[model samples]
Target: MTPQRWVYLRKLLSGFPSFPSSFSSCRPRVFSSSQSAADNMAEEAKKLAAYSAVDNNVQNNHVVGVGSGSTVVYAVDRLAERVRQEKLNIVCVPTSFQARQLILKHGLMLSDLERHPELDVAIDGADEVDSELTLIKGGGGCLTQEKIVAGCSKFFVVIADYRKDSDALGQQWKKGVPIEVIPMAYVPVSMTIAKHFGGEVSLRMAVSKAGPVVTDNSNFILDWKFEHTHNWKEVNTAIKMIPGVVETGLFVNMAQQAYFGMEDGSVKVRKAPVN
Candidate 1:
């Protein structure tokens, strides 16, 4: 569905304490009360992409999957707004602890995979998105759950800022693939990945805390920078086979569509080729 139109969630939105405006046909515009907030083009772009995804994909009472990350934060906010404005009875499945919290904070009803295994649609932010729609997620350290939700969804819609769109995944996102591993096996796992792939595999460290990041599932993260790009599907498969590797950030052939908000605040929709 190439719904290229952009529409704001709110028409008269002013000060956004955390996180809209008129649905003017095909163009979406959001204005903030604080000039500083409005000035940040990156954030504005993120909001625009999120709004486009929600307006087009989210149906009333739909079972939705919400993902983690900075851009996705705006997605949750918009989803909540839709729920409130339309009084929609939707159940949201969260991909991480943080995602669950965001859902709760916005007063969105929460469920899990065990309860509702099939998601009507899922929206997430991507670290990188290639021309083929291959993605490198897990920058938010929730790859395992995020992948599960996306894979289970009927429609997986990725929302990212313009900076994430690239000809290839490695071109825009140079941080390498994020691999989730068991805490006990991180050292050996990093070494083994480097030995096989010929790139630096570093245990992802935490900036806020003293040690490495602990994911929602209490797993450690390793960022693997491959020496050179190869067939990413093959690379993803090989990495998943390594012992103690829970999941890789590589999202191969998962996304059905994507919305990239450019620096000029325009959203570009990419659709996978149909068989």
Candidate 2:
């Protein structure tokens, strides 16, 4: 919306004291005034971090990759806000069905990787982020698509709540490396993974369904709990050697930078380690 139009709207709205604050019925009800939202520290932090990422990096970002998961939800929301307020001409590429739904829900212009193969930047959430900015993602089973989208972006930026930032990737996110694999090969693949990595590999069971959780690609998910952390790139490479493995949650050196939302309503940014 233009400032002149905003001023006109404000004049029209000032007459009606009883009217709702927002006129857009399409917008989610969760967002209100920024100061009031800061009362909920965690949510505020997530919003602050997400908004900061979008505000700073989204300039001239014609093609953007929108990620799935909770934190990225805020990023999508902020993106939509910018689209409405500033009229940013950007097309969003979704990393998963969930992300696609968010794009549609917010009325953001949506496209696919086929249409925009290279993204100016990607905003994603991580299960865990280390000091070096190594990430553990795919907790939502969108790892394969997420990695693909991130890999195609000029800048892969991660946004998350403070709890996700840790001294090491495995320290905070204890769910283990989420691996996407073919259905029939899950057993053998799990066995192979355990044999080599010395971790308990288990098929991720669905809480709402009877059997294992499946990815958007209809592949089975295997959560491998390593006994401890090691060199991430080596670990990711070794796991990828298994014949049926599609992708692992271990995002080795993929992120260019990360924004962590702090409890005190502040945001912390960690750039990738200089190699």
Candidate 3:
């Protein structure tokens, strides 16, 4: 399905009683006052990385791909700020419903793959980033669309805080790799992945609602908790080969660069090795 159709279908299904607005509401809540100092530092670091990347890459009359998640929130905010200050002509392509809302909320020009088939750059957030620049994304359940937009872009950049920057995929993010699958095939898909990958597979359940977490594409999520390391590129290919699997969170060799927001207010940049 086209990206635009996915957005429309998500909007339609959102009104159903089975699907709650927030899937992870059962997760422990943290108030701003009760948040630790380190949390505050991470927030600032995210903003610093986002602002720096935008200043360095985004230019006038560029088609940009806006990714989903919390860190991308800061990136969109900076994009809006730049648009206001420099009056840059930027067209944004959203990877999810949240991203589309962000583009509309910030009053930025919103386009799609049909209108702009090729993007200048795509900036997204990752759950974990290893030394080789391999990524584990879709922590927010937008993997399918996020992958599509990133693949279409000439340069895919990742932004994250220090907490998300790790030496390996499972070092920091313990939730495992998110795999979007057709709702009816989740059980079989889970079994197939666990059999092949030798990792615990679980259907991602929603906290606010009584069913599984639904993606913007009206699909279910299966998180594969891998215990050992393997060739990520091979694994990504293998998972995609499975039936009913729409997309996997394993992003291997896709990002051209990554900007990590450090605790000391430094932005560390990593680029993919030239082939």
Candidate 4:
């Protein structure tokens, strides 16, 4: 992760209109020229944060947890470059099917939790990160595995564009907290969350496909668009206590650090607030 190496990588990506193949298809549509420029700026910011997080946190011979989404795509690219130049012997543990594909596409060595139960670090992307380092993840439908990997890692780091940094959870990301549940219990779970939390509960539907989006673990997602904010920690615990709830997107106080790529071309680092 040398400065020269980063510059070279940045130059390589500067001309591309989209990110890596991992998420190029899902990026927002640009209507006007001005809107296209803004999209490119956001993509650049994501690359900067991803590179900075990988450079500062990853070490040789470390077992790393590769997270899902667009930001993690750049992290995987940087890791692959370091493996080629520095000859690092790092093992990658993917949090989802997309993560696994990214690892294999880049020719990185891939392992599983069965082989490496402990991890040195886990670098992930979040939908939103509050001041306390509480994260709302699972935008890519990988929340359950992402939380498990982060819980096992010694340190969890988040990378996002400046837009995702917020004072509170729902301020920036309006998609609400994604809740993965058993397929059979979706109706009851939605009703219960609405009764207890007071939010509009919608079953996440698929874009390209006909029905709902199925998770890697064969579960359905319930995106609870909460209206008011409460004690996030308590809400997270209460939601998980539900019988059919597999996992929630509410990552309360899990991240140790977060890197946000700003519009000013500088990467801002935020450490977890001490309790």
TM-score of each: 0.85, 0.85, 0.87, 0.89
Per-residue lDDT of model 2, residues 215-255, tens digit only:
99999999998898788899899889899999998888889
Best by lDDT: 4
Which of the predicted structures, 2 or 3, would earn the higher lDDT when compared with the native?
3
Task: Please write out the lDDT profile of model 4 over residues 2-107, one tens digit for every residue.
Answer: 5643564555445546545577554553224345555776888999999999999999999999999999999999999999999999999999999999999999
Cα RMSD to the true fold for all candidates? 8.7, 9.9, 12.1, 7.5
Our tally of clashes for model 1 stands at 4
Q: Please, what are the lDDT tens digits per residue for candidate 1 over residues 1-275? A: 12221123222133344321244532322233433443465687899999999999999879999999999999998999989899998999999989999998988899999999999999999999988899999888999999999999999999988789998778978889999999999988888888878889999999988999999889999999877778998889998998899999999999999998875558899997664
lDDT of 2 at 250: 86
Per candidate, the number of residue pairs that clash is 4, 0, 0, 0
Error of 3 at 71 (Å): 0.6
Mind giving the per-residue lDDT tens digits that candidate 3 earns over 134-238?
Answer: 999988999999999999999999999888888888999999999999998999999998888898999999999998899999999999999898899999999
Error of 2 at 140 (Å): 1.1
lDDT of 3 at 33: 25
In candidate 1, how many Å is residue 242 off? 0.8
Q: Which structure among the candidates has the greatest TM-score?
A: 4
Cα displacement (Å) at residue 68, model 4: 0.2
Question: Which regions of candidate 1 are displaced past 4 Å?
Answer: 1-39
Predicted structure 3: lDDT: 0.88
Poorest lDDT segment (10 consecutive residues) of candidate 1:
1-10
In candidate 3 the C-alpha lDDT for residue 148 amounts to 97
Q: Pairs clashing in candidate 4?
A: none
lDDT of each: 0.86, 0.85, 0.88, 0.92
Candidate 4's TM-score: 0.89
| lDDT pick, better of 3 and 4 | 4
